[model samples]
Target chain A: MREKQIDKLKDYKYGFTTDIENIRAPKGLNKEVIEFISKAKKEPKWMLDWRMKAFERLKNLKEPNWQKPKYPKIDYQDIYYYSAPKSASDKPKSIDELDPKLLETYKKLGIPLQEQQRLNGIAVDAVFDSVSVATTFKDKLNEVGVIFCSISEAIQKHPELVKKYLGSVIPLTDHYFATLNSAVFTDGSFVYIPPGVRCPMELSTYFRINASQTGQFERTLIIADKGSYVSYLEGCTAPMRDENQLHAANVELVALDDAEIKYSTVQNWYPGDENGKGGIYNFVTKRGLCKGINSKISWTQVETGSAITWKYPSCILQGDNSIGEFYSIAITNNHQKADTGTKMIHLGKNTKSKIISKGISAGFSDMTYRGLVDISSKAKNSTNYTQCDSLLMGNKCGAHTVPYIKNKNPESNIAHEATTSKISEEQLHYCQQRGLNPEEAVGLIVNGFCKEVLQQLPMEFAVEAQKLVGISLEGSVG
Target chain B: MLKIKNLKADIDSKSILNNFNLEIKPGEVHAIMGPNGSGKSTLSNILSGKKGYNVSGEVLFENKNLFELETEERAHKGIFLAFQYPLEIPGVNTNIFLKTSLNAIRKANGEKELDAIEFLKLVKLKAKNLKFDEEKLNRQLNVGFSGGEKKKNEILQMSILNPKLSILDETDSGLDIDALKTVADGVNSLRKKDNSFLIITHYQRLLDYIKPDYVHVLMNGKIIKSGGPELALELENKGYENFN
Candidate 1:
């Protein structure tokens, strides 16, 4: 009976794809494909040259085996390298000119792309499949000396800025997926706030995976100059499918002297169908560098949906008085597997980092928290605190915590704590006694378990994340 | 308002409440006094429909068979149990939880739901009467609350729920004299001609604040003695050693 109920919960919303026109590349990865993508976007020569070099790196790089997940060998020749709508190049100047089907899709997803245009203060970049469709509030961002646009457009228009900062923090060989993303990432948001300029409003990017055969490789970069500040949010979803899809994206942040950056992600990727038939393989690399004195960078993620997720948004504190923080809530149900956490590297004196991770595993899913905190010899008086907690829903699911702490600076104060426990039947009964149903009871307890991380999200996003948690773990209880 | 007949219950195959029987009518406050290891808490747990207890016998609330309902269903049927150890649900504010629970019960009973404004007004009135700090309603449900505060919170919940049969399961155990009096006063204010209470405690001191019309002594999983309110003072002075 329990197994049957678990199977029922495995199939959730966002598991169905719409039938729409799709323009896709031929199955293969080559220099020609890179040139084809660049030519399709009508990019400048320097941009083509960068893509060519990335292609070479992609060809030489091998898939990594260090992560806990079992990586099935992806057939680069069998996957479409690029896909978009047929008339994607014709940028819609307004919502009326946009494709009705595309607009309706975003509407159903509760993202009012049209309303965003009317909202003058906020800037929005909406990415569909492998390409960014529209960017709003450019003028407002420009007034504040903020450069926000698609990576493709940035590569063509601001080559100098892209050249100076791209892959600076996450090098080409940082990991297998990062290397792959560097080689073939089609388009993602890019933001650059000039020195001393604070972004006027929250910047947001919404990513939607529409095409079936294409893997999304989006590369995002946000650079906050000296004394500048910016808060960025990223949300993602994919069309439902039975076969597992792959999403390998990379994000890098650079915070200069006295600068601060808060990066938030609410990933609601399409998990597999019931019986664990098809879903997404989410492998992402995101890290920020606090490079100057008094700089701070924080990464907060609420990951409740996805078949198999392997991502760790990290921070590197490289300057004196720099600070780093990572708050995450990773939940898995059915047959999902998630291995996610963060890494904090302290190389400057008086640097500090804090990591709080909450993992929830229901059904037969397996969830793990893998993190590292490293204090270099020069990081005198560095302080770090890490806490990892997991809430197991049922007896079938598993939760594990693996922490690697290295402290070369004797003066550093580092504390690490971990705990793994199952949700007591008594708690569930208590919640049920308070007039909540079994599923609602489970949702309440799980939300309480991840309260710390969930509190870090924006108010609007926190509500959405809470609903997603309930929907994701719907049939895992009772 | 509530009736229990030959209520036999077991925890992990060990019988806790063996053929226990009690009747609570509207407007009446009955106190159950017992020694340690007695089934005072077990009776409360059973009435609240907690899981893992193999219960047999009949429990009727508001003329309806209570054992046939879910825990929440029982709550909706106006059966409320104030736990001795209220689970601290962090991140769930007391006001929000209480409102949700109250509205759920109201909705189940075919009553209209109260909006935030109305809820705030009701909670404020109850909090003032209970002398509970209004700020406590906004904090996470008993997350960092002291023992007295937790007991106060239970009374607060009981007051908001306005159940037909309210079971106080050692509600004054860890409370100070001031908090105990506050809690008892809260209970006293909530009492009505249509409501009833079953106060379960080890000491007779709680009865001093909220006088009970009747007292029963439960020992070794059964009620061994029953009498008027003076029975509590007798047990408190003589101890269960003489009776056992």
Candidate 2:
């Protein structure tokens, strides 16, 4: 009788899609396809050359396969490298010129880009498939000297700004997936908060992958000049009809002197079916460089999607007294596998960093937290503190924590702590005795478990992330 | 307010409660004194709708079959089980937990939800009346609390929820004399014509304060003897072996 409650929780609400005509590259990857993508974007010669170098380097590079929870083998030549809606090329100046079908899809997701017509406090740049179809609140952001647009548009209009910082933080020869991403990334958001300017509203990009046969390679770059501050949010959702897709993204952030950048993401892509037939393979590499004194960068993420996830949003504290913070909550269920954490590399004097991670695994899924805090000899008097906690909801799930703390400086102070626990029957009974239903009790307890990381998210995103945590773990227990 | 007939419970094919029977009426406080593993805790667990146990019996609470309800449904029906070891849930504020619980019970009873201000007023008055520190209300539920404090929190919940039938399991096991008296006083203050309590303890120490009207001795999963309040003192002076 009680199993019916779990049956009702199996439905994924974000699986609906709209049928629209799409323009896609052929199902293969080669030098000619690379040329096709570059010519399609109408990029300058230098950008095309850069992509070619990355692709050439990718031929010799190998995918890192040493993670504790391994990912499936990916076929390199079987994916469509570039895809975009046929109407995406028009680049509508306003919402009226956009396709009604595309606008209706965004409306159903509560994106507010077409519904309110930019009447909200947040500006959204919506990316469909391989291109940015609609952007709102451009004029208002322009009034305050904030540049919020797609990466491709930034490369076209502000070439110098894009060229100066594109590969500065994450170079072309980074990891295998990042190198592949640099070669074929079609569209992602870009933001540049000018010097001494505090962004008026939070800049957000809503990414939706519609085409079934394409691989999504999104590249994002945000630069906060001296004494500027900006907060950016990114969200992604995919339809249920998945045939083992791949999403490889590269994000780079630069915070100059006295600047701060707060980046938060709530990613809910389509997980495979109950038996794990087909889902998205998400491999992302994100890094931020604190280049000037007293600069700060913080990354908060709530990951409850993707059948197999491997990413580590790292921070490089290269300036004196700079700070870095990472708060993450990764949940995997029903044959999912996630190997995610963060890296804090202290290179300057007295650089500080804190890492707090929470992982919940259920239903035969394996979750691993692999993190590193490296303190160089030159980073004298540096301080690093890390706390990683894991919770298991069922007997079949697995949770593992591997923390590496390398303190090379004699004057540095570093502390690492970890704990693994299961959701106890006592806690649930206590909640149920107070009149909370089973799922509500689970929600309450899971929220309490993830409170440390959830508080770091923005107010609106926090509420949404809290609900998503409960929904992601539903029916995975017992 | 509650009746049980032919209650049999087992775990892992081991019998715990076999043909156990009890009846509790409104406004009466009954005490069941038993030795270790005499099926005291199992009875409470079964009554509160805890899963993973083989139970066969008829349990009627207010003219309804108790076994037909879920744990939360049983709670909404005014049946509260104050656990022997109150679970500590860190990161969940005590005040918010109480408020959510109160509103849930109220909603189930067809009452309107209480806003923050009304909830604060009601909670403050109850906390003060129970001599509970107000600062604990903002902290996580029973986290880092002393043993006596945890028991007091349970009583505080019982007092505020005002359940029609309260089954407290070993509430006096770890309390000192003063704390024990406070717990008993909290229970006594909530007694009314429409409310009832079933106090289960290993000793008769707690019954001295709440003054249960009936005392029963359970052995080997069944009630071996039953009598009035005087039976408690008899067991207290001579120990449970005296009945044998």
Candidate 3:
């Protein structure tokens, strides 16, 4: 019985930590800490001034408490704002020069940074703790006038592009957590697809939070020039810990005329133990701007981790004839709490948006689908469709759908549909009578419930998301 | 082969079955006819290993205790139950569900699982034999299906799995005359000297097509009378109320 209990919790496959040395800045959230992070990265004076501005604004900003999932008060002064592997301080010039320990860590996470073992046709930028250790396929990307590298390198190499689109979508003082990320943000991916160039390969970034007591705040920015398209995938995981850690990330996307951006994320952070003793407090802000005519942006995310998750990846449809879509599947189990969805704002004529969100709650967990669809008066003939579905496994858990819809234009149309259902005993017994085990039965039914959203993910990610969906509800069945 | 000795079942302290005894050998088709609330469904439920019943007494399948197994384990051991009320599971493709169920049983029996190509071919052949719509296989399982279509789908599944002991629990409940013949044809095609069937129903209409080797009359959870095919026609003429 004891062994079985341990085996049940072992469903989190990526809950192992690496024993690597790290260079740490002073703990706490202060000016010196922000300066230490900027100076440590050798950023320019303008970047330091920007960090200071965010810090000054952060002094008066209070943490938002209106979210459904409440957590203990986080002491900003006691948390380490910056922590990096000691070998990554000087920045390795190539994969060969990087520390083997970092490479091994990625390998264990099923993301190989080595060229020979690299995944086919997928460029990767690996971030360990507070710094990006290695980026693969740089020379090939550079061949097509595509810039795919770490944000730190972009600040020094393509400063003009970074400066133009860094805060263009998500401003510095957007919210408390976003503002904190802007102040002491560490390393994340930066991609720039030039005009008329469809990216040759899928661009991906794998994030690993390995250090203890350190909060991970990474900033990612993607810009697709006119008539260009890119599909970017982001995946993150963390080691199991007894203390709650913070992961506050800001992702911004900009698409030019006739350009499109597809962003997919598979967040498998280590949810706290069965008792919810410790886990990651994931509060992320992700948004995209369709700035040019006929531009499009779509966000697909599968969130099955974290103790308390609060995020809403949104879109600003500023271009005429632009399209925005948000497809999400969020599953919470074993005392986890998640309140996630999307926001679609139509500001241009003939803009269109679709939101499909699926939320599944099991065990003692709580899940909510909170979204907004706003069609402005100036956006004539715009249309929006939203569907929210929630599946509850047992009475101990809760699933809520909270949608805010607004249509100011007489010509515009907005339609919203919401539903709440439970997996019936008859369904389970039927599947079992047909020879499926209990866990497999639940997986099939839940996957069917989330089929509309799961179909939106990329092929490679769809398979993994399906398996994660099954593994997340391992112990929920009686 | 299956053997039951003094099997008793109760749900919520209400007696469902008491002193139930029967035996089925290979190559024999037996039909149990009973009126409503006569414990016909409870007997089938116990043999298929469904929960929520306080069961006593021993049930053996080929010398293995059936009560010690789970519902899925009993399915793996070659017990199939066609439910009276087939459930409609939304978003699960009928083809995919069949493939998963077939492969699970095959793997449990120490046999090599069938690949997609081989499995699809098998399903196609069986569906064609049953005259089931080819397009419906690609749809969500049982969702929006007519009563006749749902019953035919169950027969299609039964033919594909090819279990040793098949129990039809009110399989003729909602089927039409044409669908009933099709279901009987599907069952008759799968019948072999090594396969047995236990058909549980109210009327003897289905027994006319399949021709069970023996027929038993159940009342108040016990077999009050036992006879051959002639007994069914007699019951049909006399009605269950006056048969005993």
Candidate 4:
């Protein structure tokens, strides 16, 4: 049998420390900490009350243990609830005013925050150490009536809009990570596309976790109004450390009548050292809703980082004739573990959904694909197609699939297909006989396995994702 | 060009080839004919360095120790083997596979890589001569190919790679008269003074197209007879029962 190679997260080029003054609240979790965070952001009273409710719910909730990856004891009390770079009221007005260290960090990552903003035509929102440093291309976006800004700013400027859709899709009480993120989310991007408008350019955000002993809880909310369209990209990287860090983020997307949202994520968070000593535990909740007729939502993710990942980006197809799609390639190498997939809930008539998931497990890691496809009785003649494939690289690594299907309507047509294969020695020998080394042979074979998923990404992003896949499983095979 | 001395091989403690010896000169086409249960296939497997064989022998190619070299290293040294059963690799296109392979060999010989345009030009030329469908080059390697097409593909690969010493392991196993001519023509086009060929078959039908300079009869674990071209015809007229 041929074994699949799980990708490993290397010390990324963006892995750099930024030294700056940090204004931090005391460690430990309680009502006082939640209130301090809300007051620090100067949120409205109603928003604070909502967070308090989420916090109350979190206090009684226990961590779910049915996942395939084992969880070590996480000390929630030792994590700082709020740790900002500096001044809460006076944000940096330009790149020149921002800390040189902060600017230099992005420069090393090959994304010049200010220069690229003008030359690359990509609007960037850089979040460093629990605060939004700068958001570029604002004037051009505003000309087209696109509200692209930090969520913190959205709360103060467009209170009614933020209040109406903050938790519309993924409610605060949805899951453990979602609830925790609602109570302590410091900063994340928020976009609202006006009715009948299509955003001219792509909106992107780069999240960085710098301060030590601080957990990152970012809440991203995007709402596309009726007949509007938007494309959003999320990227993340963390500095190397000897102690494990926690990142629990919640992302909620809402598409109104005839609206379409294309969301892509390139998650390259730090996966522990070669010996599996320290890394980040990423537990995120991201979901989108087709609330209006003819609406559509699609998610594409390339996850090659994190010590342990627990995420399920889902879609609720509620509007008549709405569509939902998911494409993902999750690679786990070394001692890393990942339990990630998607959920499609069809509630309206004639709805449709498609899921393509590819999982690669290398080294001593274990990976599982957990998904749910629910077709309610009202979803008359709905249709769904799912394909899940797993590739194992070494004898020690493991890959498993657990799919749940609940079809309440006999009229609905749902099909599921899955296959698991190892990289065959015969194939490798054939390549080696032709003069390719074992590493090069593995690269060619693994790339072929992931070509389908990579095609769904944006042009430039697809190239980056391809290289990430190759780099992740570099030394695991011949 | 090649020398195999005192070759002794076994699989799972069952000896297949015992004390096998062969010597080939440059520009010579040698054929080894044998009945079933002989060590015909084992010789090819041992020379190509396929794992799981308990082989003890001295295989000298280009006056160098071939056994000490890795599979790819031996390939770089200009030793090529066309398998009897070519493995199918799904999702790996033939174009990229051939390019990577050719470049690996080229780089080992201190040659620069041929880009997509240059490589495609060379592949199309060889592919056309072998009468292969160019559309199949875009598909996975040997995947869903007919028997005749696979044999033709093996010959095309051999011609493109241009190895010095080619071992044709039962290349005529599944080819018809038409395919035999095509495969034979592919081999004859690549024949040169500095190169040699080892054609292993069970009958004299293949030798009719690509005539061999010498023929040997292998039975049990070792070769029992060696003669000129008429030896193949003699064995065809009088089967191996008399030799045993």
Candidate 5:
């Protein structure tokens, strides 16, 4: 009887796909679809011209073959390039004025729409499918000379700022997915902190994919002026489905002299079913550039849900006395695959960087960590330290580490450490002997292993991320 | 309250406890003094249901077959083991862990769970009696704790759990005289007519504070001598060679 109950509780939640109405373009890539999208959004002439140039470049760019996973050829014309919330116009100004059904969807996902009245310390910009639905605390941010709005709105309001630094860190021809994002990106958040001003509250963007058979391509850019500081968080969740979804996003950060930027991400995409049928294909490109003297940038991410994840958020220290740090915790379970890490490029004197990555694999999942540390000839007295560790919970799972280090400056100091360990039966028994069940024991130990990374998150999101970790590994133990 | 008959155990195909037999009634404190490699720690581990040991035994606790039970089930049945080397669980506050463990044991025994106020009062009183600093209770469990402090924390847990049968595995190995006395006094305070203890040690210093009712000398793989509390004194003076 107990065995039957256990089997019943192990049923997958995302096994069923929703049959919703979808408006799709014809199966082929042509200039007609680009024109149709631009016309549909009623974009300006310059914007359309920019999209046309990006489209021409996308046609010539070749797919990248550096990643580990193998895949079939992508039919660009087969995918719907543009999707939006049903009944959405150009943009909505208020939550009540938005489509009632779209608001209901956000409510089901537990994102409070009236965030301005509910939370005073967090500024939220909610993006539904392909467009920004509502942005809260705009007036407060405007008073401090800070700009927090949608990328499209930023292009219209502050065109000079967007054109000056857009694609500076991540060029249009960086990679295959990045080129795709550069061409057909729909909407994402844009943040700009002024000089000598420390933002009083955290800024956040919550992304949700609602339409079926549609790909999500968003672009984010954050620029901190001299001596400014800001902390940003990005969270994403999609509806349960059985078909693989594509998400390609690009995020770039620029920190000027004496400025600091800390970015955190908690990704809970819909993972595939137990039989490995369908889930999200997450491919993202994120990088930060420390341009001014004594600047800093840090990235912290906790990835627990996805079918195939390929991402590397990196930092480039081009300023003297600058610092860079990356802390990541990635967990894969039940046929999931993840190959994620970071890169630190040092090009200035007295630069330093640190990387700590923890990967946990369970139930036949495959996980790996790949990172690079490069110190250029001009980077005298530069230093870097990296430690990557993997913990395997079951015998059937696999873990691997591949690190690349290239140094040219003789005065630089670099240290790298990597270790792979398994959860011994003895440790589990010890915890179980203290009255903890097997699932709880595994959760405790895994949490302990990832404490160094989880502590890097902001206080508010750290609690939520920790709970998500426990929930993600609910039945993977037994 | 506990019985072992014809207990044969091995680790990695090497025999540790061969044909061992022992029994302890309620309200009695039994000290098992043994030399190195005598399997005193193995007995404690097997009683607490630790894995990785192949065993052929008939062990009964409170009239229930112990081998059929999981480690947690055995713990729920009022059996506690103080590890010789306590693990350091980072990011888990000591107070929170102690309260969670106490409440789990309570809920398993068909008792109501304690609220924050009650748990705080109980733990504060126990911590004060054991001379545990209030600040240490707020930090991560056993992370960066001194050797003496870890032992004191084990006693703090034993006190809060209030188990019917407690097994101490080398609890006094790294403790000084003052900490050893405090730990023993804490154990003596928890003694009741319905509870028992099985203390495993290499020396008789801890027995000086909490006098034992029975002493057993173990050699190789079995107990070779048994006597009253005076046997501990004799063993401390003479050593295990005399028993052999």
Candidate 6:
């Protein structure tokens, strides 16, 4: 029994793929493919035109080469741009009408769509393949003036809000992968918290990629209106495959005057096998704009999966007295590579930003914490504090911290601190002597090292993230 | 409870112990006094199942072969080693570590694990009995602790786990007189007919308080002299060089 438990911890538990049939768009990335996606979603002309604009801009942009880890060149034309469950062709009007197979898939992933089995205090939008399958507790949210639904539903039902804020935070011409996401993105969750109201429950989206030879492009946009507050979380998982998959997502957030938006992500996508055979290339763009006075936006992410992860969830402080905070814990193991951190851009007077990042690399993986903190000259009295820490396991893995700080304001203060540490054998031996197994010892130590960042997560996500922090490094200890 | 016959150990082909023999019965506190490089620490490390050593011996604990067990497995079977230099694991709370360790041992022995309240109560009582500051339990394990405080923490852990066989490897080296008394008092309180201790030290000062059942003078990886509590006094007076 103990051996089986250890074996369970050694392998990725979410590697099983559902054998459901899929309705796939023609494999390729051309104007016709983009048109097919837009038309299939029954999007309005303006949204289609926006996608075409992004597609045209994508032609001039190139896949970024600045990241530390490089993979084989992706044949964009070979990947199926859209793949959804066959039963989800015409979206279900209610959770009861949803296909049992899709519901079973999410249920097996520990997310029960059945009302009675649903996790209390959380409203979840489960996205499979390329589209959201079901969103629970919709009626309760609608009563509170909360707009929570799939992005596709939002584009049709709330076009004015969608058109106004779709690309407000991350423009279509942001970067290559982000632009790619903007062009071919199929569906994701959309949230809007009306002014002067505190969201009654946590809003979450779980993304699962089940189809083969497909690219999952999801777009999530959240807006917290004046005096409103919301906490949003995201989680992702993909089936184990012998071929690499692409998951480029764009997440944007906007906070109006006195509004607060807290975003957390526990990304546990398949990180390939121990030999680095295949995995997802998680290139994502997540940014928030504190556009109104006294607004605040914070991003907390625990990234433990993905073969090649390259993203920096950033914040742009454009309103006076606005605050931006980023707390992240990124772990890479078993031939995985990640270069993740946060970017804090201070553009308004008296704006404040704080960043705390913890990166742990094990096995033959490489991890980097690359962050940027820029305080503009016009932002008088703005203060930014950053703490970046890295932990490496064994001599085979590598950890690096590259921080870019631009302080043009003499009146502003920017404090940047970084540390690089390795778990010592003596510490492991001591823990083992105290009766903890090698795996538990490493987990406890790593969790302790990431206590500050973990504290930023919500109660439920914090517990899950803590376990992932341990499981991600399983077998790294000899 | 522990029997070792003709045990030999080598690290990187450098011999550390050869022809070493000892038997510790239940409830016996045996002190092995030796100078530097006399294999006192090697014996503890080998007995506690530390890797990187080429060991060949017959070591039985409660009639079970000790060599086949992992470090934690040995700990599960009731062996506890209070490290000479207790490691400072930054960020691991002392109280949490103690609870985890205690629960792990309990779970391994098929005993019901203690909940937080019960564990905290046990820790509180044990800390008080050892005269240890309870507030420090909330801080990172061994981090920023003085030498004496670290030693006391190891003793506190020993008392909490309540292992059947306890090995103190030079635990009294950096302790002051008052701390030495507290540590000795902790060990004395834990003394029972079913609990045993192996105290490895260079000085006879600790034995003066704990009162070991037997004292052995070790030199050059072997026991050269063995006697009652008077053996420790004789060795301390003559010193290792002349006694050998």
- State residue A254's C-alpha deviation in candidate 5, in Å: 2.0
Model 5's lDDT to the true fold?
Answer: 0.84
Quote the RMSD, in angstroms, for model 4.
3.4
Model 5 chain A weakest 10-residue run by lDDT: A1-10
Candidate 2 regions exceeding 4 Å error are A1-5, A115-120, B107-111
All candidates: TM-score: 0.94, 0.95, 0.98, 0.91, 0.91, 0.97
Error (Å) of candidate 1 at residue A173 is: 2.8
In the range B161-204, model 1's lDDT, one tens digit per residue, is 88888899999899999988899888988789988999999999
Over 4 Å off, model 1 = A1-11, A115-121, B110-112, B233-244
**What TM-score did chain B of candidate 1 earn?**
0.97
**Second chain of candidate 5: TM-score?**
0.98
Q: Ten-residue segment with the worst summed lDDT in candidate 3 chain A?
A: A1-10
Query: Residue A203 of candidate 5: its Cα lDDT?
Result: 91
Docking class of 3: medium
- The sequence of per-residue lDDT tens digits that candidate 4 reaches over residues A1-478 is 1243544434556566778778887898888998888887888898899899999999888877888888788999999978888743368777778777777777776557775444376788888767788788888899989999999889989999998999888887877778888888889999999999999888988888988898999888999999999999888888888788999999999999999999999898888776777788999999999999999999999998889998999999999999999998999888889999999999999999999999999988899999999999999999999999999998999999999999999999999999999998877777777787777788778878887888888776788888888777877875
Q: What is the lDDT of residue A198 in candidate 4?
A: 96
Q: State the lDDT of candidate 2 residue by residue for A352-438, as single tens digits.
A: 999999999988889999999999999999999999999998788899998888989999999998989888988888889889877
The TM-scores, chain A only, for the candidates as listed are 0.95, 0.97, 0.98, 0.95, 0.94, 0.98
Candidate order, TM-score descending: 3, 6, 2, 1, 4, 5
Worst window of 10 by summed lDDT in candidate 2 chain B = B235-244
Instruction: Report the CA-based lDDT of candidate 4 relative to the real structure.
Output: 0.87
Model 3 TM-score (2 dp): 0.98
- Which stretches of model 5 miss by more than 4 angstroms? A1-28, A115-117, B5-21, B90-96, B106-125, B133-140, B143-146, B217-227, B231-244
Q: So what's the TM-score on candidate 6?
A: 0.97
| Candidate 3 error regions (>4 Å) | A1-7
lDDT of each: 0.85, 0.89, 0.92, 0.87, 0.84, 0.93
Q: Is candidate 1 or candidate 5 better by lDDT?
A: 1
Give the number of the best model, judged by DockQ. Answer: 2
TM-score-superior candidate, 1 or 4: 1
